[model samples]
Target: MSAARSSGTTRVVILGGAAMGSFCAMSLRDQGFTGPITVVERDPSYARASTALSAAGIRTQFDTPLLVEMSLFGADYLRQTGEIMAFREEGYLVLADAGRAEHRARLAEMQTATGAEVALLDRAELSRRFPHLNTGDLACGTLGTRNEGWFDAWSMLTQARARAREAGVDYLTGEVTGLEAQAGAVTGVVLKDGTTLPCDWCVLAAGAHSAPLVAGLGIELPVVAKKRTAFAFRAPVDPAGLPLTCDVSGFWLRPEGQGFIGGIQPPPERDDHPPEDLEPDHDLLLDLFWPNLAHRVPAMEELRLDRTWAGHYEMNMLDQNAVIGPHDRFGNLVFCTGFSGHGVQHAPAAGRGVAEWIRHGAYRSLDLGPLGWARVRDGQPLSEGMVF
Candidate 1:
């Protein structure tokens, strides 16, 4: 289909319709852009989309000031769930060991500077606050007292999709097979079904599947799929009101329905590139997560495995941070990919930032220059220390 056949306004083609793409379309409308926005998504069910598969936690506790600011805004956006979807403000707890005291303190300073309501608690305070946790080896921990926690990602995406459609955005079910470029700028995209979508701008937010789509255009995004698993279980005792807690060992858990869900990152040597199949490694949960949980929460020693699922994290090789903004050479082609594991929490700010840049030729709300593609192009890595 030609651009005119698709729609009759300033054309914008987004390559994915999950969290990032859906939010981008909504942001464009919210920014007074009455253009023909087409979101091309291969999987509308989003069963395999990162957003739907995520643990769906949002937080303002981050090591970097930019991430802290972005997530702070994201938490605010999520607080509108009463108008979007059901959400929780259960908060997040990030624990630090003795060796990480300095690092945690520095991050706490940055988070405070960004006006995040995060409190640094000593081991005694952590023990007193969450008596179930074993804080003997912990030096300190940061806890978000407000505007943090998990929510229904699919619900948010669904609401955003509906709002975008109501605002004249087009949802196209197709796969972008190739990009059509001229004079070092992307003019449009070609779908696998031989449909051509001409656009004034294109944003790639395809998550793990983004690299192959842009590789043909000579763009190398340092993103790769790394499998992470989540297990839902029933603890022997009720751990109600438990916050999303992260251990210094990388193990984490939080409340889910009547029970709890949690997981631990496999050791570096075992964190291999995930296969096409998203099969959960039950043994990893049994051998790793179970033991870790048992050690942290004595009541969890008798937890019963309810179920498990695996999802991919689009790991950024250079610095494990997001790469946003327009491509240096292809100015018309903007990027909102390589969010690593922060996509769901940072989607709102990122989408708004991208839309603002597209509409006003600069970021009007937040300065996201630190996450621009220029960092990758200039061989400068903006490493984010908080990867969990």
Candidate 2:
């Protein structure tokens, strides 16, 4: 845990030290990156982070094996939460509408391939398993039997930051205004104050802000700020045994302390926004989310609405999947943004995979080639059916 800078040492500068950045920094230390690491974060409060604003849920009930596999690894990390970050396990459930029988079957097939403990429950079984739930409209549901659920995202991320600091990661409060490049190699970064910190490599993990940041270096990333809203409800029924459930319709809810918190994707036009400070419209819950929730679960009619908040999804225009690995053209700059809504859940594995790619020049653990920059250029649509 030494910051002793030596001549010709590989200094790595990371952008945005919230969940993704902090996890990336922790991964670097865990992978034995001994060079000076400086994490520049614009908002240390992390109030607007997708990590904090997320439903804080985890699940392996995804369509793609990579995603399910990544969450499986993430679940293990969450299981060892006490040793790594120390948090409680709440759990997650994915509800499927009668129309989504095909999608449910496909997901179950993928989960089985990965050996994930995702149980495909019929309407009767789902109603019995989750007695509090009104599964009248549900044809089936995929429940994470054991190691799947929601957690204290803020506490987990904060603990990752603490561990990264313990491992010699410097957390600097500043906005990265510019990058220092020499002959197609990243030399350092320029802060808002015009002070330049030289580095051998740079990681653009700036979430929504990453688009403009990378564009500054002539790298045109299609990452846009897609507005998403989240609302909490203090339901009449106890949410104790309830798992974090997402209606196949994309509206999701999970138990948070005494109440349950959740949200749905906004309509198309309302989804895209400029990268700026915008507030959450709680009416999206009543106008959009509630109607759908009621349709999915009849008992949601009795659920009382509580406090709500909103955040931006660093949505990728081309495909909803994340953009990992280095910029194909800019060899020195690594791009780890555009995870859309799945960033928080996939942060641990994504962070470690990118860190490994950075240190070893290839992904030694999980081959994240599906999320590579080549797909963006080749116009390949990823086979991600469940994008919410």
Per-model TM-score, in order, reads 0.95, 0.92
Question: Model 1 reaches what TM-score against the true structure?
Answer: 0.95
Task: Count backbone clashes in candidate 2.
Answer: 2
Q: Each prediction's Cα RMSD?
A: 2.8, 3.2
User: Which ten contiguous residues of candidate 1 have the minimum total lDDT?
Assistant: 1-10
Off by over 4 Å in 1: 1-8
lDDT of 1 by residue, 118-161 (tens): 88999999999899888878899988888788888888788888
How well does model 1 score by local distance difference test?
A: 0.85
> What are the per-residue Cα lDDT tens digits for candidate 2 across 1-388?
1122223377889988988899888998888788888999988998777777876677777777888878888878887776544334545677777788778878787787787887788988887877766777778878777657766788878988999999989999999987877777777788998889897778889987788886667877888877777788876767776777777667888777798788888778666556775588766877878887777666677777677678778888887778887776667677788887777878899899878877777788889888888888788867565666
Worst 10 residues of 2 by lDDT: 1-10
- Compared with the true structure, all predictions reach lDDT values of 0.85, 0.78
